[model samples]
Target chain A: MIGIIAMRDLRSLFAQPLAWVVLAVVQGLVAWFFFSGVGRFERLQPQLSRMSDPPGITDITVIPTLDSAAIVLLMIVPILAMRLIAEERRAETIRLMYSAPVSMSEIALGKFFGLAGFLLIVVALTAVMPLSLLLGTSLDLGRLAAGLIGLTLLLAAFGSAGLFFSTLTRSPIVAGVATFGLLLFLWVINFGGVDLGPLQPAIDYLSMLDHYNAFLEGTIGTEHAIYFALVTLGFLTLSVQRLDAHRLQT
Target chain B: MEERSTLIEADGLQRFFGPTQAVQDFSFQLERGEILGFLGVNGAGKTTTMEMLTGNLAPSGGRIELNGCDLLDNPRPAKASVGYLPETLPLYTTMTVDAYLRFCARLNRVPKADLDEAVATAMRRCGLEDVAERVIANLSRGYKQRVGLAQAIVHDPEVLILDEPTKGLDPIQVREIRQLIRELGKSHSVILSSHVLPEVEAICTRVQIIHEGRLVLAEDVSALRARMQHSSLLLGGRALPAPESVQGIQGVERVERLDDGRLRVFHDTQSDTAEQIVARAASEGWGLWELTPERKSLEQVFVDLTGASESEVQDTNEEMAA
Candidate 1:
């Protein structure tokens, strides 16, 4: 049942021109970032050659490019995920699922996976820009793999949060704005002044950027993976519960 | 255990939106091969009741059983046996007609082997075969309605619930959709809601009139037609007698003089009032040109049953127009 709904959503998403436009914009930004990092690396190579111990190309060029890609994803994800459930409610097409024999959990998971599948393509396309350097220079394969996994998880978390916000209202614009607002807050929560008495560690742990930064550094900590998992699962469960409550409330 | 013939049974259903009760003490049963027409004014709770029956909305207090499975407790099995088309046509406009029906069939859990056949059958039944390849957004309103109907029956559920199926269509389209609904009724038990009373009278076997969230009237179409055999008679003549003289007749309750020099006589249902009036008109040379028993239309009966004043009915008509 979940597969059926997910496939339909995927098909519908691609049928619209918005998905193509988003894909083009994300790829264009990633290419620009990748080339700029490479240009900066070329300028520093001669100075680094004089030193006995110097930074490699992966540290200076690849990490910055992947880091900038994550930021780009943050801005585009809410736009993609906004229409997942909110458009269904606005068009009154949610009644089709409600009247069907499918469970609320199935519907929520189906929608989450649908958006996740589309974002997976976006992440893969963005990663291609960094991966192309392998033909000419040695790239850090392990770090790139970790970065890919981290980006996938981040998109999943963002998609789930967007799905939850979509269930709160029938307006896709409102859902998009709410998801962007919440995600922006979580992304920058760790940037507060470091003098907090006892809440600094907890706030640091909640920052999505901090956890994603660990992946870019090639250190795939279990704690970071668990944090992403928890956020993703938490928002998906809230979406399912909100859908179930819709039956009771108008 | 429920009777084998009963397809749907809703009992004592009540729903409230905050403090306002939308539906109260609503109850009805649909049997096999029955097309039950639900009649109501706007905001009379027809859509709410349909939503509850289809498991889209949970009633505040009540029990609903579809095919003997409790809707709230065993919704999957119960909902599997039913299909619903809400007041708003639910269509994914980006999808082609064939793709949309296929998706609906899959959602309904139609077996893989029979999925193609189910989609084709639904399309053929809804007269959508010609528009199968077209995107739903490009179709005309009537065709879009057919696509909505096609999706509802794509899985061939036992109970089909349609809320105002012919709502925004021209006369020809309305007739076509009504004919399609009648054909579907032969195989599936249907519960339809409509403000077009004649459409209900034309296709439904049983009629349910809902007013103020209550089931105001429930009767067989034949029985309701019997009730429509009104006791009033329209009397037209060149020279009519005084109203007091017609009131003097036995069983004649009162006489009303119309603006066109005609008498409308209200009489007891049990008495032979028409016969007596004819005899008096012949003897007194009243020059009666026409005397016909007035048959109350379904609209008049609906207004009388709901106790809606003339202006209120006028308001309802204007609301429907706009």
Candidate 2:
């Protein structure tokens, strides 16, 4: 049932021009950043050759490019995921799912996976930029894989949050703005708690960018993976609960 | 025997939207091969009751069984047997008609092997085969409604709940859709809601009238037709006796004289008022020319039960007659 709904959602997303526009714009920006990083690496190579130990091309170019890709995803995901449930409600098509035999969890998870699936395509397309460097120089395959994994998990978490916000309203514009606001707050939450000695660690643990950065640095810790998993699962569950409540409130 | 034939049973259903009570103590039983019509004016809880029966909304307190499966306790099997088309047609406008029906089939758990055939059959039944490849957004309103209906029956559910299916259509389109619904009624139990009394009278075997969130009347269409046999007679004649003299007849309760030299007499339902009036006209040299019994249309009955203005009912009756 979940797969059926997910496929339907994914197909509908591509049927619109918004998804294609987002893909083209994001890929254009990523490619520009990738070439700039390569230009900076070439300029520093002669100075690095004189040193006994120096930063490699992966650190100088690839990590920064992937880091920018994460930020780009953060801005564009809400645009893609906002219509998942909110548009259905606005159009009154949500009644179709409600009247069907599917469960609330199936609908919520289906929407989450559908949005994540689209974002995965964006991440995969970004990976090609780094892989192209294999034609000239040796690339750090381990760090590249870790960066891609981090981006995929980050997209999943973002998609779940967007899906939950979408379920809260019948207006797609409102859902998009709310999702973007909440994600921005979570990204900057680490800075807000830096002065509090006792609360700093707990607050820092909630920062999505911190966990994502650890992956970019090639340190794939269990805590980082768990944090992403918890966020993804937590929002998806809340979305299901919200949908179940609709049957009573309506 | 009654239990076996009962396909849908909703008992003591009540729903409250916060402080306002939307529906109260609404109960009805639908038997197999029955097309039940829900008739009500706007804000009469017809849509609310339909939503509850379709399992889209949970009633505050009630029990609903579809095909003998408890809707609240075990919804999947119950919902699987039912198909619903809400007041607003739920269409994924971006998808082609064929694709949307296919998706609905899968959502209803139609097996993969049977998906194509199910979609094809639904399209054919709704007359959507001609425009199956067109995006739903491009279809006309009547065609969009057909697509909505096609999706509802795509999985071949045993029960179909449609809310105002023919709403906002031209006369020709309405006729076509009504014909389609009547054809579907042969194989599936249907619950159709409409404010148009004639539509219900034309299609439903049983009719329910709801007013102010309460069911004011429930009767088989045949029984209701029997009630439509009004106990009033229109008597026209030259040199007729005064209305007061006509009122003195044994079965007559009241009499009103029309400007056209005709008298309308209200009488007891079981009495032979017509025979008595005929006897008086012959013996008294009344020269009776016309004596016809007035048959009340369903519109009059609905208006009388709902307490709507008598003038409005007359206007609609005149329009319908024309």
Candidate 3:
């Protein structure tokens, strides 16, 4: 049933004119970011190589693809996930879904996979820029792969959070806004403008940006992997519970 | 241990939105092969009851059983048997009608082998072939409604629960849907809730009326008509004798003169013996006006059943427990 639902959802994604436009915009931005970030890094590499032990100022070729991908993800993903349940509820189609034999878990998982599948395709297409980098510059294979892994994991986390917000209301716009708001808060809360005393350790560990930090250095951290996986599972479980709660209200 | 004839039952079913009880202690039973019509005003618990029966909503209290399976205890079994169409027909606007129906079939776990035939049959049954490939967003409301009906019946569950199935449609479309429902009733036990009195009178075998979350009355079509007991038989013949003579027959409760001067006889009877009535009139050499067994109208019964007339209160009380 999940496969069946996901198939329909994926088809819907490709069928829409708006989706095509979003896809084009993402490609254009990702390509620009890749070239611009790498070009700047290569120009600085000559003077940087003369210096000993450059921390964050060294060549950014490896991290640029991951950084730009995260930016594309954070922007493009909610639009995809916003329509998952909220649009159905708004259009009164969720009632049909509710009456079907499929469980809420299957529906949530189906939407996740459906939206994730789109992101996967987009992520795959963006990899051509990084692959081209191998022809011109020395690239660390392990670090590059780890960065891609971190970006995919982060996308899953965002997708799950977006799905949870979708279940909060019947309005897709509200879902989109609220999910983006939550993501913004998550990003900003750790660095400044918030109390960081008792929650400092937990907050830092759980931060979506923090989890992707190791990927910038081209190293896969088990801690990052575990944290991201837990975030995805937590949001999905919350989404399913919200659906069950709404079903009871009907 | 009694062999239950009730195909579906709700006991003390209740739902509350904050302090307002949407449905309260609402209980009723649907017998096998019976088309149960639930009548109500807006917010009168009709859809709420249907939802609870179909396992779409959980009741606040009491138990519901369908085919002797507890609806509350095991919703899966009951829900599996239910084919529900809610007031707002849920549809995916992007998919074509055929694709949407197939998706519904897949969700219901229709076997891979059965998918094509099932989709085709549902389309054929619901008259959906002409626009099968058209996107649902482009379709007309009536056709969209047909798609809604198609999705519900495509899986062919045991019980069909329709809420306002003919809600917004032309007169002809309403007739078609009613006919479709009546045809479905031949196989499946159907429970449809409608505020339309005449439609209920025309199609349903039995009706359960609810007012403000409580049951008012339930009765079989013929029995409900019998409550009035005023038979309207039109006998065209040579006008003759006194109207009082026919009124004197056994089981003849009352007689009223029509505009044509043909008398209408109200009778509570074990059997309508109009033949015996005619025979006695013939032997008396009286010019018998009209003497035919009249079929009482269900409309009159509906009015009396729900009306506030003082004289009807006693009969209403007696028929309320059906």
Candidate 4:
């Protein structure tokens, strides 16, 4: 049943121009950033060789592109995830689904997987830019793979928030706005809590960027992996609970 | 052996939204090949009750047995045996009719081996074959409604619950959907909710009327019509002594003048007042142009049982919701 709904959502995603447009726009911007980083690396190579220990191409070009890709995902993912459940409710088509033999868990997980599939495609598109360095220079495959894994987890966490917010309302616009607000709040919390003495460490630990920055440095930690997994699981559980409560409400 | 199956047994169903009791103590039994019409005015909780029956809403109180399976205990297999179409057509307008129906079929657990045949059969039954490849958004309102019906029956469930199946359709489309419902009643037990009395009279075998979230009347359609017989009389034409003279006739308890100058006489259910009125009119030298017995319409029965018009009740419900 989860496969059925996930396949349907994926098919609908590819059927519309929004997915293609978002993919194209985000890829275009990332490619421009990638080339600029490469050009800067080309110009700075002479000065970098003079130093005993110089910055490599991966550190200058690949890490920055990955970080920018993270920021781009924060902006584009809400648009993709907003329609997962909210649009169905707005159109009243969700009544058909809820009335069917499928369970609420299946519905939530199916929609999560559907959006995950789309995000994977976007992640793959951006990963290609970093891997393209292999044609001319020896690249750090381990670091690039670490960054890709982190990027996918980060998007999945954002996707979970989008899914959870979408289930909270019937309007897709509201879902999109709420999701963006949540991601923004999560993104800036560490900076915002800097002055709140004693609570600063707790807030910093909750910040998503803190965990993501480690991955950009070509390192993966157990705590960072656990944080993303817990965040993703928490929101997906909230989505399931919201849908179950809705069955009783409606 | 021609054995009928008992498809659904709902008992003590109750739903409350805050302090408003939407449905209370609702209970009924449905049998195979039975088209049961659920009649009520707007805001009378008809849709709420249908939602509970179809497993879209959980009843605050009560238990529903679908084919002997307790609904709350095992909803999947139970719901798989039932098909539902809500009042508002639930459709994915972006998908082509063929694709949407197939998606619905798979969601309802129709096996992949028989998916094409099931979709084809449902489309053929709903007259959606011509528009099967067209996007639902591009189809006309009538065709979209047909597609909604097609999706509901794509799995060929043993029970079908339809909420206002003819709403918002042109007369021809309404007639077509009603006909399709009647045909479905030959094999599936159908629970149809509507405020339209004529549609119920034309398609349903049994009728249950709900008012203010309670069942007020339930019986066979033929039995309800027959029960009205011998209780009312429609007397037309002029009487030399005036219309009130029919009140003096035996078995006539009340007489009122209709808009068309016809006399509407209420009498004891056990008596034949029409004969007495005709004999009295002839002897009194009255011009007896027409003396037809008036059987109570479902509308009259509805109004009498609910103590308000369907539209009026609907208005009150809407106001409360607002």
lDDT (Cα, tens digit) per residue for candidate 3, span A60-170: 754776686787778778888898999988877777667666678998999899988888888777776777767765666676777778888888999999999999999
Per-residue lDDT over B1-322 for candidate 2, one digit per residue giving the tens place of the 0 to 100 score: 2335788999999999998889999999998889999987777799999999988889998899998899989999899989999989999999999899999999999999999999999999999999999999999999999998998899898899999999989999999999999999998999999887779989999999887788989999888877787879999887899999998999899999898878999998888889988998999999999989998866778686777788866665664454
* TM-scores of all candidate predictions against the true structure: 0.94, 0.91, 0.83, 0.93
State what share of the real interface contacts each candidate retains: 0.84, 0.82, 0.57, 0.78
Candidate 1, DockQ to 2 decimals? 0.82
Model 3 per-residue lDDT tens digits across residues B224-282? 55564645554434554566777777777776777876666666666465665677768
By lDDT, the better pick of 2 and 4 is 2
lDDT of 3 at A143: 69
lDDT of each: 0.91, 0.90, 0.79, 0.87
lDDT of 4 by residue, B193-214 (tens): 9886667889999999888899
Worst 10 residues of 1 chain B by lDDT: B313-322
lDDT (10s digit) by residue, model 1, range B125-197: 9989999999999999999999999989999999999999999899999999999999999999999998767
CAPRI band for model 3:
acceptable
**Candidate 4: DockQ?**
0.74
| Cα lDDT tens digits for candidate 4, A52-148 | 9888898889989988888888999998999889998888899878878899999999999999998999999998988888988888889989999
Per-candidate total of colliding backbone pairs: 0, 0, 1, 1
RMSD of each: 2.4, 3.5, 5.5, 3.2
- Candidate DockQ scores, in order: 0.82, 0.74, 0.44, 0.74
Error of 1 at B291 (Å): 4.4
lDDT tens string, model 1, A83-155?
Answer: 8988998899999999999999999999999989899899889878778888899888899889889988888
